[model samples]
Target: MDLAGMERSSLVKYLVRQLEHFFPDGQHDLSFRIEKDLDQALARLEVCIDAVKIWRKGEFDYLHSSQYTIFLYFLSNTIWRSRQDKRLCTKLFYLNKALNGIDCFYEIEMPDIFFIGHSVGIVLAKADYANYLVLYQNSTVGKNHGIAPKLEEGVIMYPNTAIIGDCHVKARSVIAQGVSVINKDTMPNSYVFQSNSGALEFKPCSKNILGDIFRHV
Candidate 1:
């Protein structure tokens, strides 16, 4: 993605136009603000790009760029958060729908950093997040019984993993595929999953599942 190219320029222009359409707050300097935060935005984008591995050998793959778009939309929302205008929030809220990321609105309190792979059925509610979080497809982290989960750093949620309720998922934990942790406090450095008997299980997780992505950060 060459920022100087016409394609990138046109895309940015279209996004700005969309923001203007939905939010007429008239922040003419919004583009400049995005550019000012480009380093951090690119850093966040790098996490998702590394997580997805769509580009190999320095070659970009257009077929899988929806992941790219997802992260970019997140970055845009994050930048707007710093600006914090009602109209901007509305723009980002609808932008989530426009990006096809179900229930992944921008008003949620996101981590200092995180990654959403393909962002399928990802519902980020009003919960606090730590850094180095990775969310796979169909994974959800939201409130249950009027309480939201608190996620620590280096927590990875595999596909269909749900951490609902007032659960405390400690650092360096991996919620395995199809597992749900509702109202349970997870142990740090553990792997939590579903057993063959349809019950949840937990064990020590000593692997670096997202090492490359975090190392780049």
Candidate 2:
């Protein structure tokens, strides 16, 4: 994959510089392990980028906020999985949050083929996320009473939507904008909307909503 105008080494340096700039306490200096694991993270990112219809298949632009947000999540998650270094992971997590306004921790296991429509105001908790999960701005997937939601494949959470607490979001289910699904279950291939009575209403949808955003949906 092409890293816009930067080489792999330059990208690594850039990430380290950002981390240092954000966390200048001298206790969060990144080790050489980041360089070693960067390739794996980029490889994972490539798979996701290639699946996206709008993004170029083989190019990655660091200046793009949404792309950078996903890349940071991948890098931080990769480092956490490979090295288990909390200090470096914390620094990367904080850097991502500061830059993207998203609260995705390094320890959370995100799917390999998910897409973030907008980086700001998105919070993801420790939920069971499947591939082809699409998240938009101000969307949240959080836990309530220690129970998180299970987002199946091809699930799309539109802008300002949320799925909280023991929700079994079935495949091909689209959560409509500004809707909050709390402790609820959605049928497969359905659209979740909020009625005037403040209750969730499921409507059968035959259209492939994820097909517009993802390839081979």
Candidate 3:
């Protein structure tokens, strides 16, 4: 994959510089440790980028805020899984949060292939997320009473929508904008809408909406 105008080494240096700028405690430099797992993280990110039809498959621009947000998440998650270094992971997590106004922690096991429409005001918890999950701005998938939602494949959470607590969001379910699905279940291949009386409503989806964003859904 092309790293915009940077080589792999240059990208590593750029990331290290950004981290150092954000966290300047002068304890230990992160160039060596971050570079160790960067290749694997980039490989994972490549798979995700390739699946999204809207993004160029072989190109990654660090200057792009949404792409960089996803990249930081992948890097932090990869390092956390590989080395289990809490300090380094925390810094990366904080960097991601500071740069992109999102609260996706490194411990949250996001899907292998997912798309972020806008990074701002997005908060994802430790939920069971499947592939082709598309999240928009101000969207949330959070836990309540220690129970998180289970989202199946081809699920799209529109802007200002939420799926919280004990909800089984079935496959190909599209949660409408500005709707909150709390402790509720959605039917497969349905559109979740809120009614006048604040009741949850489900309607069949006519087309494969995910096809517009994903290469194969």
Taken over the whole model, the C-alpha lDDT of each candidate is 0.67, 0.90, 0.92
For candidate 3, the TM-score is: 0.98
Which segments of candidate 2 are over 4 A away from where they belong?
27-31
RMSD of each: 4.4, 1.3, 0.9
For residue 140, what is the lDDT in candidate 3? Answer: 95
Point out where model 1 deviates above 4 Å. Answer: 1-11, 17-76, 196-198
* Residues forming the 10-long window of minimal summed lDDT in candidate 2: 24-33
Model 3, residue 17: C-alpha shift (Å): 1.4
Count of clashing residue pairs in every prediction: 0, 0, 0
Q: How well does candidate 2 match the true structure in TM-score terms?
A: 0.96
Predicted candidate 2 versus true structure: per-residue lDDT over 1-217, tens digit per residue: 9999999889888887887778787754364768868889999999999999999999999998888999989998998899787888888888889999999999999998988988789999999999999999999999999999998899999999999998999999999999999999999999999999879999999788888999998
Write down the lDDT that model 1 would get. 0.67
Per-prediction TM-score, please? 0.72, 0.96, 0.98
Q: Considering summed lDDT, which 10 consecutive residues are worst modelled in model 1?
A: 53-62
lDDT by residue (58-80, candidate 1, tens digit) is: 22232343544454556656666
